[model samples]
Target: MSAGLRVAGVDGCPRLADGSGGWIAVIIEPGNAMKAERIDRLAELVDRPEAPQIIAVDMPIGLPKRVGPNGRAPERLVRPRLGMRQSSVFSMPSRAAVYAALDPRLPDEAERYRHACSVARATSEPPRAVSRQAFHIFGKIAEIDGLLRERAALAGRIHECHPEVSFWAMNGETALDLAKKVKNAPHKPGLALRRRLLAAQGFAEALTSPLQARALKVGEDDLIDACAAAWTARRIAHGQAIGFPTPAERDGEGLPIQIQA
Candidate 1:
């Protein structure tokens, strides 16, 4: 990679003991060296002195006001491409529902979840509620959503990516046979399969190597996924990436809804 070019792959991490969960970024900089960093806010990573030119993050980016039976176009388009791994993509609800999940007035998590579901059911066709997995990342979804809304330029730099989608592209558009997690726990075979793909993409050993405390407060899967996201970021930077939809779609707020890899 050129010294002037910098890109990153970012993924959300589990909350630590003190309830501080943020984002993990695998940055590819000059000399093709990889650097891992923990950021409490996505903006922190974006505004750093050596900020990446492109950031591929594993999280939902656009939010629609009302979703149809197939959900958002991006989700609908990419799900089938993953085959058995399609379940990894969660159906996102309406913008109102996502915003409701972070309602400051509803301090109780259970209450907020119910309220968000109620809003989602009303805004979606065929009436669907927010899934627990989707609800859990609403904060992250909201974080990037709000930032993009506040500064439209970042939307051009920060793109939405899914690990499976990135890996699928890296694997010659073939979906992997294994699931990264089973019953909510890491699966070694699946993780190893992804590492091989990353290694082939020119990711350094520091990233594909065995897990260590190199980047604290994040799971092994988070690091791998981030690297996969970074792989897509590299493609994106080079104009070689493809969006889920042939042409990117947009939300009511004008944010691009396509997942690029």
Candidate 2:
């Protein structure tokens, strides 16, 4: 593998429509297969390089500071829950937080909270069904918590897995914020650079095969997340490290974290 930064974009539970049911796609390079695999695959890919720089994911990496109403406000929030099994509810809040934290500007706390709530509502099944599903998959509510804890644990593991690689969670909000800033800026060399970034993302989509696209079905949100991840990776390759925001710190609108490598 080349010594240059190796970056991967992960989009999980990507939906095809407004309703429930979506798939996950891990786009390593343009036109790659959208295979269903563990997040560890990302780590594995980065490890191939002597010192991979970054791996950006679209899944949630943290839990809410406090649970919402309805037994866990975040849990109750995922929108379309039609065909989804109850077990998926366990991943909702963290996913929302992950998405929210990736954005640079969220407008305000209310916007951030609303966005989180909306994501939760969209991903979760009905309350009773989710409770039953959790029991079936985990044996009890406590077991569900265990699963959640494990998911959160990955935040620390990203660096450990590759040692040389840093991880970031990218979401739609961050992408939009970045785009706005880049697009609104006065005509300058930076505008061309921004367009190049978007072009790379589009190239990635075009390179993707029909079968892969069908399988991954990268949606609007997923595409934006992937673009942000790609942009972050590009920055890392150029010697910049991207930081993630904490749920409390995000006002729900601002520039995404820009970290130093």
lDDT of each: 0.88, 0.34
Candidate 1: lDDT of 170? 94
Winner by lDDT = 1
Q: lDDT per residue, candidate 1, 130-153, as tens digits?
A: 889999999999999999999999
TM-scores across all candidates? 0.95, 0.35
Which consecutive 10 residues in model 2 have the weakest lDDT in total?
A: 160-169
lDDT of 1: 0.88
Residue-wise C-alpha lDDT for candidate 2, range 67-140, written one tens digit per residue: 33443332243212212222233532433433542345875655655555555555444321222222222211
Task: Report the C-alpha displacement of residue 142, candidate 2, in angstroms.
Answer: 12
User: What value does the lDDT take at residue 64 in candidate 2?
Assistant: 41
Best by TM-score: 1
Output the worst ten-in-a-row residue range by lDDT, candidate 1.
Answer: 208-217
Count steric clashes of candidate 1.
0
